[model samples]
Structure formats: C-alpha cells, structure tokens
Target chain A: MILDVDFHSGVPIYRQIVRQVQRLILSGILGEGHQMESVRDLSGRLKVNPMTISKAYSILESEGLLQRRRGIGLFVAPLAESRKASQSKALFDALLSDVAAAAVQMDVDLPQIISGLTEHYQKIHSQKEK
Target chain B: MILDVDFHSGVPIYRQIVRQVQRLILSGILGEGHQMESVRDLSGRLKVNPMTISKAYSILESEGLLQRRRGIGLFVAPLAESRKASQSKALFDALLSDVAAAAVQMDVDLPQIISGLTEHYQKIHSQKEK
Candidate 1:
C-alpha cells in the first residue's frame, strides 16, 4: 500500500501509480486477494487526481493484475505461480539491463559496481527490518 | 551522437535528451571540447521539435556540461576530473540503490542479481567492442 511518485519526474502520475502497483503485485508484496486502496482514498493520500487513480486501476484491471468485486473494491488477481515467476524475471532483467548499461556508460568498473550494489542491498535490507 | 527517446514513456522528451547527453559527457564518450550536434540537425535526426532540443541544450549549458563557443556551436565543457568522478559516483550510486531495492522487493537473491548484472555488463561490453 506504500507508493511514492515524483511529480517533477515528467512521468505521468497515472503511469507511476500503475507501475508501482504492478511492482507490488509482481513482487508478491501484495499477494492474491489483497484489496487495493479505494480510488478516493488513494487519490487523497497521493494528492493525485481521482480520475488519474481510477485510470491506473482501470489499466491494472484490464491487465488482469487486479479484479473488481461489485460493491466492494479491487483486489490482486490470482495469478499462477509460474506466470508470476516469469513476469518477475522479465521485469528484473529489464531493470538489471538498464543498470548495467548506465554503469558502463558512467565509466564505473565492475568491482566498484558490485560493491555498490552489495552496499545498497544491505542498507535496504536493514531498513526493512527496522 | 547516439540518443533515443521513448515518446510513449510518459517522461518528457527534453528530459530524455538531457539525460542521454549527460550520460555521454559523463562517460567521456563526448570528451571536453567536443562539439555538439547543431540543434536543427539533431532535431531533424530525432524527429523532435527544434525547441525541445534547444531547451535540453540550454539546460546543459547552464549546468556547465555544455558551453557556447561564440558563433561556432555548443561544446562539452572542461569539467574538472575530480568533479566528474564525484558526479559519476553519485549518479551510479543512486541507480544502484534503486536496483537493489527492486531486487529485494522482487525476492531475487543476491547471487541471481549479481549474475544478471555480470551477464548484462558482458553483453554491453561486447556490443561496444563490436
């Protein structure tokens, strides 16, 4: 249920919402049947337009990542384990590719990049534990 | 001299141009004093509005990444080596932090992420060598 969006990032608010929600679901942080925050509540919290939130939810629903139950709300869909694994792998691979390309373009050596990654992993892991 | 913009990515075209140019300069691919492509020519090549390309160049110039050479054209500025090193570290670290967070959230183990990074690095390095 935690989402962050950078208004100045030039990326559309709706797309940011969609991407974060997709990440959460694909990561299994929001497992099957997890109820999504209502459009109104999420818009209020995110300070985004209600329509934008609705648009993001609609996209997720259409993508079969979320399902709507009448009079209730949207929930994460029961995606097959295999499908989730493949999707996560693809998403992570794309991210890793970007990181690798950027590191090389920035003249960062392999050992330095590896150490940096390890540092970040430990830092984030510790933060999560707290 | 190579830049790409994803028009459908929701990120602004000018920002994309700025980021790519910055990457090129920081990587030393576009060395100090290297002339930048004229705005008109680059716009024509990228099929983006000349104004958008101009805006990107202007911003880079203000950031001291590009300099105007009287009536010639924009050229990469002679940034101090230490400054470049620090800036590159900061940029790469930010990217690494994001990647690490995503990997942890996606339940990817350290070894898998490391191998993925190594594979991408080798793939990109070979491509560049080719």
Candidate 2:
C-alpha cells in the first residue's frame, strides 16, 4: 500500500507513512486481512531506512490493524470494527470540535458543513453503487 | 485535539496523533475550520515533547487541514475540499487494496468486506440522520 506522503513538509517521514496508511485502513478503502508492503520493500520504494518502515508497521500491528505470522508477511488485521470504535470516537470528538470552530471562524453555518458532508457521503455511496 | 496514541504499540506517538486526527476530519466528524489545541497545550496534555506535537500539526497543516496563525495558535484551516480530494484519494486507494487483499487471503469474498463496510457506512449515515 502507498504511504502517500508529502516529503517536503516539516512532518517527519516515518510519521507520514504511518498516518497515510492508517487513513487507508480506517476509511474502508483497506479492507480487513490485507498484506501491507514488507518493510524492506517499502523502504526500497520510499528510499527511506528500514527502521522507518518497520516502525510504521509495528504501529499498525499494535493498533490491531496488522497481524504478523511467524514465516508469513505482515497482513492486515481481521475485522477491526469493534476494536476501532472507542478510539475512533475520541478522535472524532477532536475533529468535530476543530471543524465547528473553523466553520464559525469562516462565517459558515453548521448546516453548510453538514450539507457538504452529507453530499460527499452520498456521493461515495452512489459511486459504490450501494 | 488528542493524539490518541497507543504507547504500548509499535507506532510512534506523533504519527498516531496525525492519523487519528486526519481520520476525524475526513469522516465529517471534524468539520472544516476546526481549531485543534495549541501544540503547547496538547504537548502538556499528552506529556509528550513539544517537538512531537509540532511535527504532527505541521503534517496536518501541510495537508491543508490545519493552518498556522501567528500568535493566535494553530487554527484549523478553512475548508479544503479541493486540495484534500487528491491526497485523500491516494490514501483510500491503498486502504481498499489492502482490504481486498486481506479478504482474499482470509478466504473471504469481496462481498463480505463490502457488506461490512456498507453496514458500517449505513450506520454512520443513519446516525448522522442524512
């Protein structure tokens, strides 16, 4: 999976890999039980140190997003719905508060944000043909 | 805004913050223009290094999710729909591929992942009431 990083940004490389990958998993784009790039492979692809990739994978594993097998490669964890809910709720709280503040600052009403989000959500649904 | 780190897990702390927060914004739980806690405040709250918080915020800001306002603390950037679309798409690509691979590996079919994701997506939509 691609880490999707903007290397020019001040954010460190390793964290970028972690964040982008995590985003993929949580968004339902990465389904349960997938194999991520081997750390060595990703390191080669990103031209970064293996430690960096290893670090990212380790994080995903700990979040229960990735599972490790003795001889097999690192694979996506299976069915993380229940595991992610609590953590996701806390993250959402911060995000919602931030967005609310931004909307207020921009003189945009809450309804506007809600509408835009609803539109996007519907778009995703329709695109998925669900 | 909390970083939502799992210190015991293998992922680095700052990266955890970035991923979780990013998820919040994308999920519509965090609306546009939201104000995250100042780096100093967050650093203090999490008892982590100022550098860590700074690093995470810098990534978000670069992604156009957060804006650095001089002396006003780091505020959430204004709505960034156009900019985020490209970046978010790439992240989702990796996520979907991973999930698909995982489903195949687990002897599960695409239908299962799609169904689960669909069910969860529906739950989110209904909860939002839109």
Full-model lDDT for every candidate: 0.89, 0.62
Clashing pairs in 1: none
lDDT top scorer: 1
RMSD of each: 2.1, 10.6
**TM-scores of chain B alone in all candidate structures, in the order given:** 0.92, 0.71
Q: Candidate 1: lDDT of A102?
A: 85
Local lDDT at A98 for model 2: 40
Alpha-carbon shift of residue B33 in model 1 (angstroms): 1.4
Write one digit per residue (lDDT tens) for candidate 1, span A6-47. 899767899888887888899899999999999999999989
Per-model TM-score on C-alpha atoms: 0.90, 0.44
